[model samples]
Target chain A: MLEIRNLTASVGGNQVLNGINLSIQAGTVHAIMGPNGSGKSTLSNVLAGHPQYIVDGGEVLFDGVDLLAMPPEERARAGIFLCFQHPVEVPGVRMDHFMRAGYNAIHKSHDEEELDPIQFDRILKDKAKIVEIDPLLLKRNVNEGFSGGEKKRNEILQMAMLEPKLSILDEPDSGLDVDSLRIVAEGINQLRSPDKAVLLITHYQRILNYVVPDVVNVLINGRIVRSGGKELAAEIEANGYEGQGEALQPSA
Target chain B: MTTPDSLAQSEYKYGFVTDIEEETAPRGLTEDTIRWISAKKNEPEFMLEWRLRAFKHFMTLVENHQEPKWANVHYPPIDFENGVYYAAPKTNPASLEDVDAEILSTYEKLGIPLEEQKRLAGVAVDAVFDSVSVATTFKETLGKQGIIFGSFADAVQEHPDLVKKYLGSVVPYTDNFYAALNAAVFSDGSFCYIPKGVRCPLELSTYFRINAAESGQFERTLLIADEGSYVSYLEGCSAPMRDTNQLHAAVVELVAMENAEIKYSTIQNWYPGDENGVGGIFNFVTKRAKAAGNNSKISWTQVETGSAITWKYPSVLLQGDNSIGEFYSVALTRGYQQADTGTKMTHIGANSRSKIISKGISAGHGSNTYRGLVKIMPKAANARNFTQCDSLLIGDQCGAHTVPYVEVQNSSAHLEHEAFTSKVSEEQLFYCRQRGMSSEDANSLIINGFCKEVFQQLPFEFAVEATRLLEVSLEGSVG
Candidate 1:
């Protein structure tokens, strides 16, 4: 479970997230739909503890622990995963090597037995299949020269491997084709469980058709304006984010 | 007692000086110093004549003030007369057992155990302490295979013919100012020779340690692979922390005969001074390998992570038809360290080929430069060379430069060059950190990836040590 109480953040001296308040229960998928510059990505970055994003005001708690105080790596080890909109290219860093380092790091922080290369390979291969990622790509550098669809699928693969408690998919469907989008949606659907939560941040409602959300919240100007069922996604799709903030009351 | 802050501040882990009585030549570089070094080694008359000739030439260069001002590095004029030319542990060890415990412990502390039981498997080591080699492991085993592996001083006495024939054959003493200086006062280094048609059974290594303060270590390493022979040689250099700069002018020459192959790797970790860069070793080295006969091959793999100022170019002279030359280097300069290193591939024989891959990493106020040359003569038909230079900067104050010169007189020659410079982006760092790695680990991971190509060229154990060395060298380089 996670709780955000009037969380305000800024980036590069510009206030982006203006007192955002949201609460997500375990096992529920929450979709935050907003237009560009509405601070959807800012919220995701602030929650993941990105260094550039300063917490200007308010507080965020993950399992009753202060999330804003932890460093990015500590937040990651504590099971907060943010699938980047554009994954960075880490030249010469093999995907498997990077993943294994992350896997062992998180495991060690939790006092769990770490998996060696051989043991980890089996788990990686199985997870790769669930995400429909070509195993050959795992031998190459991380996100180096990866196509748009492949990058999204790679992020899903990492999500599957890390098994985070709260997964923030930031524009995962942004540069994907129909077939790639279907695969990403299916991967997310397969990763859903009663002990986990998914916060899907997107500007488009197309992905909502594939992995329907339990709660759909419209974010306008860094604040959640409307909260409704999955039908709210269809409503937004039919009538975009324009004038939605003025029409709907702020949700508690 | 060292705090974590001090440890990170001065990441030169091998900065400890061995406390032992030493026999040092009087401070200064003169004819008497050369004679003392030659007499101390008991070198043959021909060897002494060569040293005198070199010393005379070195004096001429000094008179002309030709201290190689072409390189893009800045330093105060060196005080040659104020530094000791030779400084060695007092006792001369006739065998491993006779080696002084303090000297042996110095090697052990450096992770290079001279004891038989703790010796690294398949790596015959010759531990050079200051001016003389104190211990040579697996000498008998190597000798049984008609492979002469021992100290250069011993080779001058035992295998004078081999030493005389190949010495200065690739990098002549007249080649440069430092080469002449090294040839004149070079105290001792490893000497190896593989007989015809023999592949050396194990790796040959030389570990040079500079413990005596205010002494310059002039090491001369010569390796010869006879016709149809093969050998892999590696050299490691380090020095203690000092307030005054020490000089390390070394010359390494390798000869690969017909159908022979020679592979040379170096892990140079001399002291890079404190964060303020007050004192350290000035490593001026000349390393060259010659493919003397048709179909021979020579490769140089180096990981240079230390030294206050490094100026060296490990080159390959492709004199034989169909010969191959390769240079893989990873030069990392942190703090105020400066490195100007690369390679030269000269194609004199038809169908000769060479490949160069260099990675330079600069952190703090460090400066790194890759200055390489690829030349193909008019008579050399169908020669080929491919070069790739990549530079990585960790902090804003650091700098990287790539200067590649290509001269092709033959129209049939084919050459290609690629160079790229990139900063350690904040996004890359955040990406790795978000994957659960600490900032240090993330920085190291990114650097290791950037250096993967060069590290893979090293031998297994050397590769592992080189990786760890890069990690240590990059300490405190980032927040």
Candidate 2:
């Protein structure tokens, strides 16, 4: 469902994602793990069409469409959802209102009927249970004065609302506690289906225990150096990627 | 949507005028013109004496005015003597049914259908054309509620006791140059009075339109919410395009009695001139509201998107214990328009509180500034204030400035002020684009998001209207 060919990106004239190439098919889950400043976040930001990231080379295609040519909102409407590491605090924009806007934007693009407040409330209430989020929080300003765990769960709630074709969880487990991690994992598991893809971007192995990926790719210095099955994640958890010289430059 | 080039060539939607205009004083600012206006309005002896005093003060203030160069706005010198001090619609019927159809049609063309606007605005409307109130709607219904809603001229004659007591009590004759001028030659504006303990059922609305050339619009609005009463008032303005700058000096005074609440909202869309700044209204307004009794509240919400040079500061005087004041504004200036607007919150009572939220957007070489003041007097112990001013600059050529003055004399008073100025980043735009939005849509979304805080303070209907106005005003320029 997604393909990246020799993606080289920079931010403020500094190279961040260098010569990165990856591919993932529908109904598959891929985990990209790397240390801080190793371009893990940069890769997610570039894929989500962040403006600050300058794409110097290569192209990205989603479902055979030129992904790079679309704006961030268009990309979102095209079913590409990015769970921000740190969700933006949009003051005065109620959570339900923001979710409705996102849902309508995507639904309109997909030629689906828009949900009114009543219908949306029913759907959002059910999804709220999956993420263990308080329904009352949905009525307040988006992410305003929310705890770290609440913000991460709100991100998952938004992801569920959009129901994107490709969901990129960029360190969704960063500020979550054990309970929140379980709730987030349960939310992702419920969202998993035969027609959707998930890209789990993380640096720790704790989240893998709940939502294990079908494939694991080790990213270092902008490039994915290793690609293997679920066992690869277990192996990396036992022994970090410090001494895997041969796997450092694995074939894309 | 029309292309930028087409819109630029299109004539203003409200460029027409009624031909039935009759009475008009000769263009000039002198004792004779002031006397003519006072006499035409049939003012009392004391009122005429007040006008003469104000006219004398206006002459002195104008000489030392110095044009207030500090504001980032420039306009051609206004010929005080060349402006018609008073121009009432030719036919003045005593009732709405007697109002001229042609003049009413002009209002209909302006999108303020008199009867419908009267219902939507809630309070009686004293619609002003050029320099006079053409018609007032819903006066009887409001009068039945024991609320005095009518034109200032009518109030001066009918409720002389209240008018003489409250007029100029908050803002004296020498308050400012514009206030002085308004006090001198002000033709007509709305006068509202809410009886004690009565929650006004309707929103009072006043529509001001400048239809004549070189005619100054000096309007005076007075709203008094009696003790324990509550009221909300709205004012809107627009004008025709003209080569020569037109002076618009209006004074609005609001008094909230003990436990009363007064909300004043203004959406000023005066003629802002073309990109080259050829012709526009020089809007110099003085609006002041006073919390006259304990626990009274006053709030001001304004969406200013027009005028070549707008210099106005709607202020609040907290004179009662635990009084509260709030100001929410979104000022947008584009294409040679300059706006230096904000509010002043004066805390003079114990435990008084004030909040000021100002959002400014500048594009197309326009200059927008937020100049606000928060003063906590020595007696205002335990006073609290929070001020947030944010500016969004669209193009590199435009400028956004923040000048906040805070004075806290009581050591127990707590004051916090924060401001931020930044151009929308390309990164944020790209992020939205990647989500499948057009560049224009993304810019609009971000701008709207930036203004969400202040917009939320508006009434639900006005919020939607303000958002649409912002979108239309920023169209074709959002990159």
Predicted model with the maximum DockQ? 1
User: What does candidate 2's lDDT look like per residue over B40-159, in tens digits?
Assistant: 888999899999999998888778764457666666667675678887777778877788888778788876777543445544567888877877777778888899987888899999
Range of the 10 consecutive residues with the lowest summed lDDT in candidate 2 chain B = B1-10
Candidate with top TM-score is: 1
Candidate 1 lDDT by residue in tens digits, B1-479: 12123324445679898999999998888999999988988888999999999999999999999989999888999977667999998987778999999988999999999998999999999999999899999999998999999899999999898888889888889999999999999999989999999999999999999999878899999999999999999989888889788899999999999999999999999998888888999999999999989999999999999899999999999999999999999998877889999999999999999999999998878899999999999878999999999999876788899999999899999999999999878899888888899888888899999999999899999999999988877776666
Show pairs that collide, candidate 1.
none
All candidates: CA RMSD (Å): 2.2, 3.3
Interface RMSD of 1: 0.6
lDDT for position B421 in model 2: 88
Model 1 lDDT per residue over A67-148, tens place: 8889999999999999999999998899999999999999999999999999999999999998788888999999998999
lDDT of 2: 0.84
